[model samples]
Target: MVQHFNFFYDESEHSRKINHSTIVSENYYDNFITTIVGWQTADEKIVLKKYLDFEEKYSDRKSDGELKSTTLKKRQFKNGFASLNRDNIEFILDLFSIFDDNVLLYFSITSKIEYIINQLFLNYKNNIWEDMDMMRYSIVKAIVMYQPEEIISGMYENTGELVQLLKTFFNKRINVNKTNPKLKEHETLAFTQILILLDDINVKFDINWNYDIAFHGFKKYLIEKDISKYSLFLDREGDDGNTLKAAKQVGLTFVTEVDSKEITGIRMADMLVGIISKLLKSLHEELRYDSIEDGLNKKILGEGWFNLNEQQLFLYKQLTHIICEVNNAWYKSFCGIYSDDFIILVSLLNYISSFDTVNEIKAVDKKMHGEHFNAYVCKELESYFGRMESKLPIDPIPGGKKDYFYNQRGAKVFFNSSKQPLLKINEGCNIFNVLSVGFSNDGNAMITISENKNFLCYRLPKELFEWAMTCVAFANRGDNVFPSKVQFTKNGDRYYADVL
Candidate 1:
């Protein structure tokens, strides 16, 4: 007979419209931090006693028999953990003490805007992360940094409008750069990435996408942890009809819904999730977890933790230590960020854990990386199109129209002709595989250069590739031609070709 462990799950967040302007996910309330506290059947009594003893101590203050993270008065939390009275603080520490080798705890964070972006970009078909994901993640971050508004609005509208809005934005940006030249590198990257991913699919963003990441993490943990069988008892508030279903996806034989206020285990989960959500929200607003060697407490103290109280320091160190202890089993645990703030959160958690994280995360960056990333294409796109990648070019900046603004709209924005020699993907009978760089067919400044079948105009640096593609595309936009899907496999190498 297969033995079963037990899990009590709880969540701390509400459904809200995603705030597009926010960069850091934890800083906003639109996101969620859901937690799972689990243990085997043999230790069930040990688990109940912890909550039992604590409830007995606080019986007079509440008599409710449930310990909530909000046990501290709302205004009191302004002082951090110091806000909790000594007796209640011990209650929290005791609950956390149960999070050991046997008792399991995991935290999952999801951002609303990040969810929408992932959904808008990661449609079932035309998904960019299938095989080659080298630039997919970095590409999304670049988009978020440069065109958060365009993408955000698209989620509320047609997903295809995402493409049109981005085009207008980048077209405007590229035109403006010709004058002022302040376009950031990521903006250029985001431009190319958008163009590359412009598909006909009209996938609409759903509110449900917000819960997918956190739930997916939950499912994966239940599915993979120790290859063990388990029964899940989710908090009543967690029964949004999705959490229970999400947990079931892992094939858990026994998943029942119960009130957290009634069950000791779920109440512990509620308490832990409550504290964790507050911890993340506070830290995100107050600090950046950049240090690799120091615990959160030590790092804060080292950085002149003048705003913090002594009890806050002690409590954080204690809690952070318990959280990091979970990292030891993080492989099956997946106890980290899974949403828009993934890079920042993983880096932060690796930075957040007070103990050595060498064993915690093996390839955090390459977690979602598939075999799809085509380095050659990334390179060619950069070298051929990376305009003004170096120093700001001020020479021969295009001047405003000599004609009146009343005659034409805004100086005709972009030029139909190129003063500078332009490059084109060679589609010739005799020329074969070569990039036609500079000049025209009249051969004034034109030169034919050898090109690869896979990669574009030689190799460009990965960082600059996206930037260059945007430049090349915009530069050649007047021709009304854009490079569509460049797919090659069965026959031989089909190089760069344009679509009308």
Candidate 2:
């Protein structure tokens, strides 16, 4: 008689048994199908033929002998395996159906939906649902259970969150690591195709979704912060020369016509520029001053002057002097005064209009663009100094024409020849005195600046085009040089270059 020994099972042993059973079951299933199916299914036969044809077309027989051998072995294995899987032929069919549906959905969303559907029915008739009927059934069941619209709406509400959930679900069912290259590629392709479809749905529904929402939100924030005030002068309709002139005239009339008593103290500062202009014009017409300084002092310090503190009085005098100088200088240089001077004057008026006796001393003169002067006279005067609501009432001077001079090697200078005097290198030929010059990327284009404030662009010559191209590439990547002085500098005796 033999004695029987009993072995006690632990949790680890139980887990091992379960794991082994799963492995055995999978192996058995694979082997069983291999034994049953005799390979050479009509659909797989076609695929194999196509694969062989592609190999023949692209692969050189002499060079790819090793590759061909390996490919042949794989084909033999695939044929043998397919032959053994007769009972599970339906599985192959099911896989085909699932693939077809996925492709259909992808193309449909891409606006090529009709073509994909037609291909599924006409071209893939035999292969459709041939290998994976269970997968096909499951996918169909999912489609029926959850409508496309519902999925789209859910995705719209929380795209990131839903994509994460889908990834988790696929990982659990597929048992493949998401990080695997093949799996990741498939996921990316599928998700991108689905996203294309989602975009179509969003457009059809007239929903303003996606990245633009954030941009619009930012714009709203800027408006709330009063940045829109700066853009007011940029308004095309109201900022024309005629409109600006009318606005200035109206503003001047409004200020001068209203009696000092009728005008609110807060608003008086707003009208200051117009009132001063009118007062100055009157004085210049009726009582000619021997000098500009005397005329300003007489206007502000004389008997009819409004009450002002020491600081206000000082600012008044300073502003008159500054305005007179700017006006005179602009006329002298440009041959005529532009409406730009009026913009500065208006800013000054707004500043003065807000001045109060209590707060006048704290304000200081602030220059506008180095050309015009502005000052804050009082805390109450701050609002009147609001951005010029009116536009310049003049047609902006059209930009000057550019003249380009190119050297044999593609180095070029651009300048407005009509405005600036050019040095004549020959008869009817001029060389621009360029302030700056450089090559753009690819060496084909040259950019230059001239003394007359003009930019020049020219194409490089053909013979040195390649070297010029390289130079351009290098120049684009080089650090920008700010010209301190326009002169020639010699770093070495042989290497002399212009400093810009």
Candidate No. with top lDDT:
1
- TM per model? 0.54, 0.17
**Looking at candidate 2, what is the lDDT of residue 274?**
24
* TM-score of model 2 vs. true structure: 0.17
lDDT of 1 by residue, 1-500 (tens): 55578888787765534443343343345346777787878888887786678767666655365567667444444434645666757666666666667677767765544555556556432222331132334434334434345555665655556657756765655454444334245544554555565544345656454344555655555533543577778776533566666666655557888887788888777777777666455434343323211111211212222222444445555666666655444332332212333222233333323323323223333322111112322344355234312222112222244321111111111232234223433334223232322222222332233344332222222332343454344434322122333211221333322221
For candidate 2, write residues 116-146 as lDDT tens digits: 1122223221122231222222222222222
List runs of model 1 lying over 4 Å from the truth. Answer: 16-30, 60-65, 72-91, 123-154, 157-160, 167-192, 199-215, 238-240, 286-311, 332-500
* Cα displacement (Å) at residue 103, model 2: 57
Worst 10 residues of 2 by lDDT: 29-38
Clashes of 2: 33
